[model samples]
Target chain A: MQTKETIVCRCEDITLEEIKSLIDQGYRTIDEIKRVIRAGMGPCQGRTCRMLIAQELAKYYGIPVGEVLMPTFRPTVRPVKLGTFAGGE
Target chain B: MPKVKETEILIVGGGPAGLSAASAAANLGASVLVLERDEKPGGQLIKQTHKFFGSKKQYAGDRGYQIGDLLIEQCGNNPKVEVWTNTTALGIYEDGVVTAEGRAKHLKINPKKIIVATGASEKMITFPNNDLPGIYGAGAVQTLMNVHGIVPGRRVLMIGAGNIGLIVSYQLMQAGVEIAAIIEAAPTIGGYLVHASKIRRAGVPILTSHTITEAYGNESVEGAIICKLDEGWQPVSGSEQDLKVDVICLAVGLSPLTELCFQADCQMKYVSELSGHVPVRNEHLETTRPGLYVAGDVSGVEEASSAMVEGRLAGISAACSLGYGEDIAPKLQAEALAELSELRAGPAGQKTLRGIMNLMDKGGAVC
Candidate 1:
């Protein structure tokens, strides 16, 4: 496993220090932390950062990792062209 | 006599838009009920493991799942809003009634106004072995890896370069899976340049003007045969490339779930730009069918951020139609229009705008 020092949340390029600050700010939930710091809204989505955030939130809240909720996946899971959708017509 | 489960408004879909709609209406002092098919709210945002772009007010730079949580908290903490999870809205009746099924029990309820945030369904492309066991939608892969903690495959061949395709390829890498390649029939990468740049930097080959013609596995996808396309999309001669991969992820596109709107007999039009046939909705997000409203992908295929704005508009629009704070609807409508316009600004938004224009032209209505 990569060390905890690796920058996971790329959108904000959030480091461990900033995430710790969010936890100190009473943002225990991943969602709350994200809203406060813009941690996960980059183009890569949360692919690289979600698990790490979950871990940090758990450590901060003193909760088990399983208690944390994951994000919902929607369709078009890849970027699709609108033109292709209408081509059938 | 039967407990009188009633609210001034009902919002279906439980996605970002649905949650926002409930929050928007409740904040306006209106009683609201939100129905979600999933065990929890947040819709696709829950599975989105990506960061978002936009302004701070929109939670730009937040992961999709985090946004889902914030919205859920905002909606859940409000006394005026009641959210039902694992509740499937079976159908939308003409008289502003919603039929839902939960725990194998069916129930019917009526609200003064309705907002259809039912979202859209994943589309599929027909190929010789598309129905094979290993073939799945890109969204499904996300659910498995990001949500369920199970990798979709050891090696994957992605078809499509739109945002979904590109993003998933990167995600598969994050999950420690190898991406053989991403194939798109278009001459250029379809999704955002930043997204493409990420995977490209990671050494994943994005083959444009190429497509997977067939999957060659008896019952599971073992490998795929890809080919380059001419201007007419016909496979050019001798352009075949074969890939060895366990999973084939289709990130083709989504089709709006406008059937409920159509069933209500709202003014419907086949707008190719809108992801499929959609209901003709006005500035207030109200469908032509007076009390009926459509939000999120069902209105048109847009992101969760836009869905939130549209959801707020739809909820406010519905609340106004129900005779609750009717005067405030116009102001809310204007704000939503402005927000949506801003969200649609940028290079990637050009195609979306084009799609919306096509939809508007087909409906012969002003956007």
Candidate 2:
């Protein structure tokens, strides 16, 4: 139960305690948590932590995990250099 | 703008599904281009060393990697199929222009029909210290040991009793590593009894209704704490057990990697039965967006056998839409559908069948 130190978002080093506290403080959605705590903004782009966060939110609200709306996935799904988009080889 | 490369059918993610699609479409005289993000053409199939289960048409008795090789060979031999490795499909535009990043350059491909066989990603569970260096997804462990010949750890604690968990545990033992125990949150083992018995005979206990609570390590995984779960799935008090383990392997489940479908503005429905959010598609596997299709895990998480069948179905369907294989397309399509229904007729395929029904029942834009 030492959740205060249990890391949830490995990229941003956010902890489970931080996520739960955010849920308790009315930050219920994964997108909201990402905006506030930078959970899904890392290079991995939430591949690892988004679902984990969604599960937490679903648990707190006593709702099914699928009911939670996943955040929008933007273009260039993988991280690419600006030059790549500029047609540079 | 650089001149956009054009093809009749473009398949993304050259895994079992993508390669199969490429072959199916190319055999029908459609110019097929496959974009694979990895260095090699085979997707997860390359790392799976276990023999597959299914009808003989799917190469059931052959090892998974061998089947992958067969699919790759078929595509390679077909002059109509062009596979580009180390090329990542960045996005699917509304205008039907697919942009991708090749080994050293950005390339835009204009294909008349697109097949999104991007596959799925492993699901993770929530537990304290789960992010330690030694902890990894089951697929990652397979990749390290089977593909690269590097053992992950000396002692491993596998979480989940699904087929992947059991198979990976057996594979780990094959690589001369010791498994502490295999734990499952479910009350009963979820994988085939055959796989379960293989590891059980090896003396690795399968602890059902048990879950890992925390991993103990500073720089990496050194140990873990597991406990029995109650009917409500909450950890039972006073049932915690500590075990010395160097690696924690998670084989919880997989969610379809549908980011490309979402980017393409395809209508998506979250079917838990499918394992996660999936794009709504029809019997032919074409998505809400015309000229766009999804095969394999991107449609729903299922066995590789089913993924291959789905790939063939989507490939022929996409090719048919492009006016290729006019005379033989219907018969091939029907055969693929029958084979799919047969694959789903077993007890294991019921969940996938239900998931597909849920998606198709709520009809989307006609392709």
Candidate 3:
């Protein structure tokens, strides 16, 4: 696999190589990766990429996929316009 | 302040589980409000064209969509149940106010009890060029071909031999599309033999212990590279096979849609047997937080049959908590529990049974 070109986070356009390099640097967990590369900080809010990242981390750490703690899910589950929340039309 | 609508019971999602819950709660004389994100209330059932298999109570031998229609009709006829379509639940606040956006307006709902039957989302697998066009989740393919009259593509490579994969392959054939092959990473097929037999009889090859290494395409899916896996699940070198296909459909399983459950601070546990992380709830389907209940895939991924039973159990339990149907709720709850156990008695139900037991053992409320 061409890790350099293969995309992992579609929303942020992060690559597999970027994620792997971060893991090697000891930046583990989806939340840490998200803070550094904005992987899960997009509009979809990690709906598509979090699990993939979890699987990658699990493979690297030799742990069960479920043992990888999932990132915290905040409110406004789906994206809503700022105006909608501020009582604007 | 946004318009605040009050109801005795609030059910999130209007699929088979939510609709059954709405009917069950309404039958117990509770005013129920159901919120559905889509334009319609059937959820996944709207795209299923094949006949369902189950006991008669679950509408066995009836087509999937027809069963959906019946459940919709039941909810529609009940005066105490109100369904809001195209409404998405945005958040569950600490103060017990649920916010939703729909129909060009944002509103807040205050209900005495809440039942989350939000269902699950399709799981995705990573490979080269997986983000290219012409790649779709199995549900999206069904929506394209079954819901709309448009065919997805001329030929397709299907990943995962689960029931969704096999059934969608048959549905694609019925829509005049060619299936290149159906592949499963596991050595044995995951779906029912009946569904597998139908596609097998149609001359489509079912390959087990195989997986796609990469999708070949510049812009859209033009082909795929598949290879066999060894005992360790590593792809064998020099065993690669290339196939010509336009569409790649992934039916590789699903994870529960539990964003709201997490937001509400319900106790959650990761049970891989149930697919992914799920809320820890009691036999009555009530989560750790009182008045917040879960049914269907929101609690744990299971069949539509068990989802309906869980919905009914959650519905009656929630209504009974709100001081409705006290005389008959116990009987109905017991019946629902019995039906659920019976549905989980087959060999196929072993994984789900184990998942449920794990949840129970890990401090799920006994009720």
Candidate 4:
């Protein structure tokens, strides 16, 4: 049996083991995982890890992927620096 | 506060569509300006090494990057067309005002017309352990190997049989990476048979009706488990097959990035055939809101060939509306539409036709 040490969320460096452990602890939805471990809340802004986490939760619950609640996406869609707004950058 | 800029025609995105629009509009004697978010102007066109497939007018034999450069060169040569690299159009505000962040200065542009040509983003697939570091979207991998000139991994497991997956698989192989397998949930390969054959001749097995069940590794992607799917697309429990791989490339599809269009108050509708919600535009590529237009993937998830055609249509329409090139506008738009219709007449284009028809039937094409 392979232990989960592979990284799922690279930005925050969250591991597969950590995610599975969180799931085992009964965090069912993606929102719950984001709440517990911050997998999707990162600099890349979940563009990389969002679908992965959503599908993982869907698979773990043996549900359709479309059924998984996606985290709400906000705009500033492309990264805009706060400093750019303040004339600092 | 940044200085406000004014132009006759303002185009967002500097890829094939935007550049084509700039060239067309500027050639018609309208002052055109293009704002691209990237440091360079090619968009994803820079990351493509393969020659595109279309008629000679669309550069059927030339490489994608070459065509991109050609578009830029011609557009750049137009005295009336100005391109600003590293410029991101933040939004198209009400009253036809636009705000953008430029490399050297922030810009508030008031243009006579606006065209949004922002392209699409890669779609992802779900599988157990998909979050592993080695997993990547086809676009990301293309950007890595094709754009940055770095091989992403030693071995790749390609998911989906679409053009991006097929093309990227070949591009990776050309770059000295081994492909373990290409698994598609569809019974038949999704892309052109020609592309599928090229990979097949290279000794890569095309596994149809199969899907990745999970990817497993401790530190990175070391292996993947694929399984055959039943009629309902559920994994057939006993058909699990594992393969050793370092990277998993998902080339499922692309969805149009219509955020700017939405911000501009363009009506959007969910059309699965077009790869998701796209801005509703009339025959001339004009959206419901006057003076605002859309082209490229932002209008609908179509090929670069069609994007260019649509761009020319919008460019000509906008230029004519502003009292430039009125005599030739109708002929030019008709030719663009004809070329687009022919390009979409292939076996691959039937679906696009259906998608467009579906949208039109649902009033998504109202303008």
lDDT of every model, 2 decimals: 0.78, 0.89, 0.90, 0.83
Per-residue lDDT value at B285 in model 4: 86
Candidate 3 per-residue lDDT over residues B154-260, each given as its tens digit: 99999999999999999999989999999999999999999999899999999999999999776688999999999999999999999999999999999899989
TM-score of each: 0.78, 0.96, 0.97, 0.87
Residue pairs in collision within model 4: A6-B218
Q: Write the per-residue lDDT of candidate 4 for residues B196-227, one digit (tens) a residue.
A: 99999999999999998789888888999999
Off by over 4 Å in 1: A1-89, B1-4, B326-328, B362-367
Error of 4 at A81 (Å): 2.2
How much does each candidate deviate from the true structure in C-alpha RMSD? Answer: 18.9, 1.8, 1.6, 4.1
Q: By lDDT, rank the candidates, best first.
A: 3, 2, 4, 1
lDDT of 4 by residue, A32-53 (tens): 8887888877765565566567
Could you give candidate 1's per-residue lDDT for residues B156-211 as a string of tens digits? Answer: 99989999899889989998999999999889987988999999999999999898
Q: Give the TM-score of candidate 3.
A: 0.97
i-RMS, every candidate?
A: 19.3, 2.8, 2.7, 4.6
lDDT winner between 3 and 4, please give it. Answer: 3
Worst 10 residues of 2 chain B by lDDT: B358-367
- Over the true interface, candidate 1 deviates by an RMSD, in Å, of 19.3
Misplaced by over 4 Å in model 3 are A1-4
In terms of TM-score, which candidate is strongest?
3
